[model samples]
Target: MAPNRREKGNTVSDSDPHFSGGGVAADGFDRFGTLPDCLLVSILSLLPIEDAVRTSVLSTRWRRLWTLAPLRLLDDSALRSEKFPNKKLLAFRAFHDEEQWRTQEGWRVRAIDGVLSAHAGPIRSCRLSRVYFHIPLLDGWIQTLSQKGVQDLAILIPMEKRFYLVHPSLIACQSLQSLELCYCRILKPTQPRPNLVNLRVLNLKRSLVTDAAINDLLSCCPALQSLALVHCAGLRRIHLRSPTLCIMMLDDYSWEVEELFVVDAPNLEHLMLGKNTTRRTHVKVLNAPKLELLGFLDMSIKMLQLGSTTCFEKSMVTLSTVVHSLKKLAIRVDFNDDLQADIVFDLLRCFPCLETLDVLIADMDDDDEPDVEYWKQQVSLDCLDHHLKSVTLKGFLGQRTDSGFVNFLIAKARVLKVMTLISVHAWKEGWVETVQQGLCLQNKASIDATVVFMKEKHEINQFQPWSSLF
Candidate 1:
């Protein structure tokens, strides 16, 4: 039998049998236990926290090794499982016994506390979701992790009316590089604002934060490069002026925001704005000179004013030279909307240097047909005549309107090299051959232009069908 468990203060001496070559048998065979400490710690880090802690019973040599491994504790499995009764016996019992629910909840809390208390090394990351934690206990855990030099932290709670304010220690931690918070309330700090000098990435989703609070946070993080805000309330206007910010994504599906203004991010490269279904918001891009990629999905905004223009009317759009630097553009169009077709043309004209265009067709009802004559009447744009090389049409339903639009692109784009048409629905008997034959008959401006037909199997953004070409 193994020797008695060693206390935390005990140190392994070099002369000890277990510390030396005891794992090697007399026959000269090395056992798995002979692996070095660093390799063993790595293996332990990959297992779940509970399983890793249970390994302490294997032998005296492995008793305290878990304390040295970087810990990652995520309490999301219980919430993610559909059959909750099978996950924990106590959970099943909780349905009948209120005391059992408290027991199970206490066990979960203790499990997290035990692992965090026993850890002797830096925690690489911690993501806690769907666990009900009191404000004091949550604050204590955040403070403890902050002091432990945690680099990445994510706290995601359920979308209940209850809002847990973030601990001050977490905001002021200098060791933190990435932070993501979901479904929580961010309280404004006291005067002489805190600075997260090392933070590079920040994501806030479904959180409540005032515009002033957001500006204050951004002002302190000089090194912030990427910021994403999804469905966050309490901000009617968002003004970003970061110098190092490269990517900004504002996905507001709730349509709570009324205005978004990108004031002066010079280094910004990619900007994605979710469709404003309410059609009440307006976006203005004042100064991102280096902006190359732009995506506007489900766009129904009243106005998308570019450059320093002050006009808010939808008909008064005037593109500046900054948008001409764009290399790629993605947009979604609803055929039912009369302005959508005109909006596409206006956008293409603005982005004269665009090399690739991705179009997602929305609302495929039979009554919502594209105006074929309107597409035919569109004068050739500079992008189609010179810069555009690739075009991807997702949700192509093989309608007369879709075919007319495809034919218009085929005949006008002189430098077009590849045109990908992904069917909106499943493949039928002669769909591929029919589309191919139709596209082949249309007048192609470039002899090298190739039309590729594919069935829609996955999301438009998840897989890039054009990656093989590059």
Candidate 2:
């Protein structure tokens, strides 16, 4: 036996008789290792991410092959596995202790740095979640990623902890396309502000995004298409005037948002608001002719202005404010009184040609009774009479109040093709049959209409939370 030596992060045996002069015996068993560099790199790229990285241990030649493929790095998900109730309680306690959480996540951040040091471009994406770091380290990492041509990047800080300031290098990155930040804050760019010309998608959740920060960023993102702001604070007024933006979502209830006024958006299609039932922002649209999909419109908006028409406290449809261009509409309703139910009718009248209606029902007490006369006084609107084809009701509890609303919709939607009742809080065994018989779904106005039922306590709709639309 002879000694084995290490060289340049690789292992080699100088005393092995079977290996010599960069060539192995023709009849040897090392068939795959004999392949060319291009083929070897391609093969390594096909393997799973971890498997591909482990191949670097094979030989000196193989060590650098993993670096040639695209880089997708992650040091995320510190508590993703602790989803059980007992585990969640334990995690909830630890999560609130900032120091302990930071200490535990320190190793993952170190590993992220190690991988970046060892890997080569082009880095496709990098995701860092639940890992807090000192400002300097995170700034350095962002610079490194920009240099490596990172296209998609996400950094999610833990909730209830202090937020990090976004580094300027990230915005100045020439090759970056998508950026998602959570629990962070953005400073208004200084003199000679950098432009994110190539950026396309921007999603900010639970961040301290000031109006100045957002407006400045919006001006620089000439190519942005999708924008979502979820529960973000410090935005008093959001005014967008873009030619390329197509999808925009606003879920922030931060009292700062006084008004969302879109002055000009030539290509805008989806303008989704929040599902908040308590407060509403005055949304005034001056120009968005291409707007086709609008969702989760709360009944009590401060002032809904589409073009010149002012939507106010009235619960009646006015011809001037009709949004006939809207193809799909989603709304949030209280369903407690005729007043609240009339607001829905008014909304339907405003969108005479709506094809899809997705309604989110507010949670109500079981013992409470609803004013059924206001619902009885409800006449079929143009949408329900001729245009509406699909109806999706979320949070149906099969209560007496629920039966009235469901039956009203079932009877009036003459063209309704499908009605989905997502029962999130119904516990009774025969609740489904009860809702069916009580609502008289089989006698729905639309002769060929189909009914769909779902138990959705654990699974939400695909386009819910209003953030996913963008």
The models' CA-based lDDT, in order, is: 0.71, 0.73
Error of 2 at 389 (Å): 1.7
For model 2, give the RMSD to the true fold: 5.8
User: How does residue 243 of candidate 1 score in lDDT?
Assistant: 91
In candidate 1, what are the lDDT values of residues 277-345, reduced to their tens digit? 225667778889988877753445476767743223434355554467788887777654556666677
**C-alpha RMSD for every candidate:** 5.6, 5.8
Give the TM-score (vs. native) of candidate 1: 0.82
RMSD of 1: 5.6
Estimate the TM-score of every prediction.
Answer: 0.82, 0.81
lDDT of 1: 0.71
Q: Model 2 — TM-score against the truth?
A: 0.81
